[model samples]
Target: MHKNKNIKAITSFPALKGRLKQLTLCALSGALLLSVSACSEQASQTPEQAKADFEAAYNSISTERLKNDIRVLSSDEFEGRLPTTEGETKTLDFLTAGFTEAGFKPGNGDSFFQQVDLMQITADPDMTLRIGENEFVYKVNMVASSKREVPSIELSESPIVFLGYGVNAPEYDWNDYDQVDVSGKTVIVLVNDPGFAAADSGKFQGSTMTYYGRWSYKYEEASRQGADAVFIVHETAPASYGWSVVANSWSGPQYGLVSPDQGQSRVKVEGWLSRDAAIKVFADAGLDFDQEKEKALQGPYSQALDLSASVTVNNSIEKSKSYNVFASLPGSELPDEHIIYTAHWDHLGKDETKDGDQIYNGAHDNATGTAAIIEMARAFASLEVAPKRTISMLVVTAEEQGLLGSKYYAENPIIPLDKTVANINMDAMNILGPTKDVSVVGMGKSELESYLEKAATNQGRVLTQEDRPEAGYYYRSDHFSFAKLGVPALYAKGGSQPINDEIAQYRKRMNVIVTGCYHQVCDQFRETWNFEGITEDTQLLFEVGYDLANTSDWPQWNATSEFQR
Candidate 1:
């Protein structure tokens, strides 16, 4: 996203400066006039007339095709579509072929791929957490990873400190690092902010889990404090996930963008310890973990513990190039302005260390979302008229790896951000059936909500905001990357309505997938999935985009939105 550049006036005389200023104002006014005229012309288009053929093309999106795509993508052949793997090549080829078949042209200078450089780090730690003389085994007691650039980590007898939430928000008049000389030591931090612990939503964005609550923040704060290592004590409730989810995700091939300084500014190691392990470690230093934790969060408090630990990590690093797939339908009027659709095409690759089924197929996790976008692309191509603004479908990689692909695109957008109208991001859409309501995550943040609501209403559906704000879903998806740059984005899922009357059934199925199959090898394609829901969800997306396309009105973030310019 390019920032606005200031233009200076050229003056040859004392009176010329004022005259030049007048001329510049006139030019700017003329430009504004042209822009407003164009906007009015486009915004005046009859929605009913423009969308007359929209339903037809949207109907052309076949349930069978979507199902077939998901089936293959989540199958054993693609190897979970991990970035920088054989599976990546196959996935990219599949998306490109689909785009070609759907009347889309190559978006990146006659190439469908935009190369993204990424680095993979797998930590094989010969680690032991020693509290005085008592030693605990790694992985079982604690699992560690690193963002540092080095190949290995060695920290022996580093003293420990307990910092509640590990937040340093001067705005909130709080600093956990206050009165601490933490140089070259380790910091033991809590998982989430006090908002969750206090069961008070009014505290720290009201149980919404501010950025300070994230474990990544803990590590970064520790680094800023010049700590050698950071270990976050994990509690399922505050973390909003089970410890196994942490173990599975952090233990394998961890990834990060190629840092400019090769991550030298980062702490040597970052990890998590189970509550029991944390208790034992604290107790070994003649302190009770639970009691200390209560005091730590009491404000204006921090403790330099007598506890010390040591570990050594041997890392296997691999650097490679992956891609974000861009397929475009050139605009009939405004070729430079764009409406972007993004879905991640990558999932966690096969974990051979697992027993039998090794691949984390990510069927409902994201394969379904990727398939939906392809079907949407096909639908847009089948439309009677080309959109007024370019419509691009982007299948990004490494979303499961903490939104790496999307972050890269945000930093290096193929198109200028100011010219980009809006982004529609789909991840793990509804596979249950049709619904009377459509769900929008971060619903109130932008004008796109009105567009989405109108489109959903036309289809006899209501709009629903995210039910669980505590999960902080708006910050977790690829859409956040665009939103952070002040681009109006709608991050949606199929949650508002379900066709089936058995209310408990949908939740049961979803819970089973979430708790058991999410990020696990069991997330394979299922024969029982009903694609009608996702198909309808895709239709809603198409209609909303159609509404945006015929109108030149650029959506803007609401005044209350954090990303508002």
Candidate 2:
């Protein structure tokens, strides 16, 4: 059973001002100050005094507090914390109170909420895809949806073209759509990049998937090629998950930022086809899937199959507002420069069609990360004096919906990209016991990783790369939004190595949780789950951000990184 804390109602502007005034009379005030005497006092402290001050603040991150917050947020009453719903309202209120309690002022001007206007399109499940004489059912062999905010979208026997991986990377000198006009046609693409298929060190980054391998890039490139519809053939090993992940993720109400032309710039239809169904389609065209894939690895490949695809998507569209919640511990000296921490605050909402459990309580998926941010705020607030640069915490919405909220923030930023020092993102935190090593997602992307390594070293833990680099977990999260725009972003957590031999059992359980319950209804808060690992990871991130905030240095992306400015 979960217990919801009876948090006080959100403080009004006048009351908030009074609270700030009262806090200013005390040490380490919550209010943002440009030139406070407390800054001088903090600067005057000896090294020993400063270390004691840091320890006091760092030790304030309580595992019990994090556990309770996750329990409350992931409870059924939150309705899976979906954006633009009653769940969103409750989540906003809860976060507003949490930020207030943590002594953080609104990062956005006079408001904690940054309203992100979105177009929500829920597609009808009762749809069919016809490939010549063969027919495939929705959620069975195929899952497709239209980004275009229209009542219905249809394709009538559009010519099908196999466009290899559908990647147009100029740096790699690879373009599958080269000399091929896919205008007004449907295209079939393979998941991941040719690097994974070829397994050759010279191709792309060998097994390490690049941004070109992402499905979003595929859809975007197809749109640029004027393709009416595009479908990626899904394979479990390359895509890193089962067909259920695609089916469950795409079947829901999809959200995109409100566009001027109602997403007309995007392809009319985009989705995935099960590998089995794709093989059948290839066979129908008198082609073998394995043989074609092998040929695709050699170089650019495209062929006009003798099949035509026809499908229609009936969508229920609603124009509404979701929010990116922001709260900050402003700097005393360099208020303009900011060190931002981000975590997504959304998950798959309730599904009425399911038998008993319908809510996707995304406890491990994000609740742990969100809770850690709130705790980090408290740690910052407990400092003897504010950091030199502002510490901003942003909890974005609709991350489960293709990172819409963060994308909106990145495109329309409150803090200028040039002024932003670094972005530390937390997602799906470790819930098993502590580990001897910390894992860096998309390692070697930026210099911000060095700070993480230093922090991990202080904790007696080493740094390691993610076990599954081929999964492309980097592009799948909110940090990718910042990285794409040149800001250095770090996403790391407890690596797989257990702290001691006694915790081997927890590691086995973690594997089961990550593989079995991801994006499913079973992703609920478990009482047996350990919070020590998440707590340590939170502290490590806090140390990194805290160090960055106090220093004048701005970490940049590695020269070899694709996201380099």
C-alpha-based local distance difference test score of model 1: 0.77
In candidate 1, where is summed lDDT lowest over 10 consecutive residues? 1-10
TM-score list, all predictions? 0.80, 0.87
Q: Considering every candidate listed, which one attains the maximal TM-score?
A: 2
Per-model lDDT: 0.77, 0.85
Cα lDDT of model 2 by residue, 1-565, tens digit: 0111111122232322323211231255476433332243345567797688778888899999999999998999998887766777777777878887777877787678898886667899989999989999999999999999889999889999999999888778899999999999999999999889767658888888988898888999999999999999999999988998788777866767898788899999998999999999999999999889888888999988889999999998867677899888778678789999999998877877789998988999889999999999988887877777888999998888778899999999999999999999999999888999999999888999889999999999999999889999899899999998888999999998999876878778766866778777899999988899999999999999989988899888887676773
lDDT of 1 at 256: 74
Residues 245-307, model 1: lDDT tens digits: 777667866777888898889988888999888888888778888898788667746777787
Runs in model 2 lying further than 4 Å from the true structure: 1-49, 132-135, 276-287, 306-308, 349-359, 506-515, 520-522
